[model samples]
Target: MEPFKVHILGCGSAVPTNHHRPSSQVVEVRGKFFMVDCGEGTQLNLRNCRVSFSKLQAVFISHMHGDHCFGLLGMISTFGLTGRTTPLHVYAPADYATLFERQMDYFCKRRDFEVVFHPVDTTRHMVIFEDRSLRVESIPLEHRLPCCGYLFREQPSLPHIRRDMIDFYHIPICYINNIKNGAGWETPEGEKVPHERLVTPAAPPRSYAYCSDTRYIPTLHELLKDVSTLYHESTYTSHEADKAALYYHSTGEQAAQVAKAANVGKLLLGHYSARYHEENQLLKEAKSIFPNVYLTDEGMVFDV
Candidate 1:
C-alpha cells in the first residue's frame, strides 16, 4: 500500500490566535501532495512538517475567504524564488480568476513556472481533478460564501499476483500484468487457467473527505458515505449551536452527527474557534455523538 495520509498544517478558524493558525492541510495520496485551504502561515507549517515544497501537485481552495487563501500568493512567490519549474495548478471559484491573475502579474513577474487556474463551480458536485492514483471531486457545501468540500478517492490498483500459481502454471513474466488485470492463461498443452487461480483480489479503495466552514447540511451524509476518513469543521460546541448556524458553521456535535450518518471510518474535527482555549469540550461533545471522532491539531498526521 502506498502512503496515504493527511497532515494538519493549521486548524484554527478565521481569527488567528497565539495558540493556533488558520485553515490549512496537506493530503498525500500515493506520494503525491495536494494542499487544501492554504491559510496564513501555511508555508511555514509545511516546512515544519518537513514536506518538500516542490512535491505539491495542486492547491484546492474551498472559497475566496482570506483565512482559506491568504497564504497562496506568498507560497507561489516562494516557489518561484526556489526555482520551481513545474507548473502549479490552483482550483478555486471562477470569481477569483481575475484577482489571481492580477496578483501574479504584479507580484510574480520573474516566475520560472506557470500558475494555471481551474474555475470550480461550488454549486455542483463533480470531479474536478483526476490522476493515475486518485480523483478529487467537489462536494457542494452550504456556507456564508460560495464554498465546496473536497472528496479524494484512491483508484483501485491491479490485483496482486499469486506466486504459487505462477510457479505451478509456469506462467511467463510477460503475462503477469495481464493476469493481474484478470486475464487467464493457457499452458503448452492447452490447459486453461482461470484468472482467479493466478491472482488475488485487490485491496479495497479508500477515500477521504474534507469539509470546512459549512452549515449542518444533511446532504453531506450522502456525499461522504463510507469515506475512510472525514475532516469536518467543528468551529464551536453545541452550546453555541445557534451562533454556528447563524455563521454557517458547524458545531462539534453536528460534525459528529454527520460522521455517524455517513458511516465514515474516522472523523477528524478541525477549524476550531479561538474562544476554546482547550479542545477538550469540543472533543467530548463530538465523542458523545460519535466515538471515532478526533480533534485535529497542527502537525498531526492521520493515515487513511
Candidate 2:
C-alpha cells in the first residue's frame, strides 16, 4: 500500500534534556513533506534523520511556545544561506507571523523566497488546507497558550491497474493509464473497456494526527476519531497528573486516554518532561490504557 509515514525529529518539551530534544516532526504523505513545529535544533535533527529540507512543502506550528518554535528563525536563515528560492508555506497562529518577521528584521537578512503564513484559529476546528491527494485540518486544543492540533488525511488515490485483465485484453499503455486513473477507455473500433474490468480499488487512505503541549481535553476525541496514527505529548507520568494540569501539559496516561477514546490505530507518545531519567515508565503507563502506544524518540519513523 505504500502507506505514508511520519518521523519524529525531536520530542522534548519546554526544557531540553540530554535524552530528548524539543518538539519537531515530519509527516510525509503522497510524496510530499510537511513539518510540524520547529523546536531548537530541528534542522540538525532533520539532517541527522536524512530528511532533505528541499522536500518540505509546509510547516505547521501548534503554538508559539519556545519548545514548539524556537528553531524556526534558524531554519529560515539556513534556508536563505542555502539559496533556497522555493516559497515556504507556514500555518500557525496569527501572532507568529509578526514574531517571525520581527526576528528576520533583527537578523537583517531578507529571505530569498516568499514565506506565506496561514493563520489558524485556535478556538475553532476546520479543514485549513487541501490538495489533490491530501487534506490538513486544524483541531483546537487546550494549552497554556493558544494552540491548534494538526490532522493529516491522505485522499484515496485512483484505482490500481488490473495486471491480469490488462494482459488478457492486450490493453495499450495509454489505455492502461486511463484505467488506472479511473477512466473507461474506448478503442478506435468503438469498443468500450470499463475501468472496473481493468483495475482494482486502491488502498484505503490513512490519517495522522498531531497533538502537542496540550492538557487532556476530551472534546478532541471526535476530531481525532479513527486516525491511523496519533502523536500526542506525554510530558509527565500519571502520578504527575496534578503537575500536568497545573502546567497545562499532559501525563502519559492522559495521552493514552485520548488515543483510546479516538480509536486511533497506533499511538506515538512524545514531548517528555526533562525530569524523567527513563522513559520506560511512560510507555508502561500509556500501554496500560492503549495497547498500541509507542514511546517516540528523536529520529523514530513510523509508517502510517
Candidate 2 residue lDDT tens string, 1-304 = 6649998899888876888898999998877889999998899998888877777889999999998898887887888888788988989997777877777788726877877878888888899999997999998888889998999999988888888877777778876676777787666688888878888887778999999978999777999989999999898998999999998889889999999999999999999888988899999999999999898888889999
Model 1 clash tally, residue pairs: 0
Candidate 1: residue 279 Cα off by (Å): 1.0
Off by over 4 Å in 1: none
Q: Give lDDT per model, in order.
A: 0.93, 0.87
Off by over 4 Å in 2: 169-173, 181-194
What is the alpha-carbon lDDT of model 1 when measured against the actual structure? 0.93
TM-score of each: 0.98, 0.92
- CA shift at 83, candidate 2, in angstroms? 1.8
For model 2, which pairs clash? none
lDDT tens digits by residue: candidate 1, 24-108 = 9999999999999999879999999989889998999999888999999999999998989998999998789999989989998
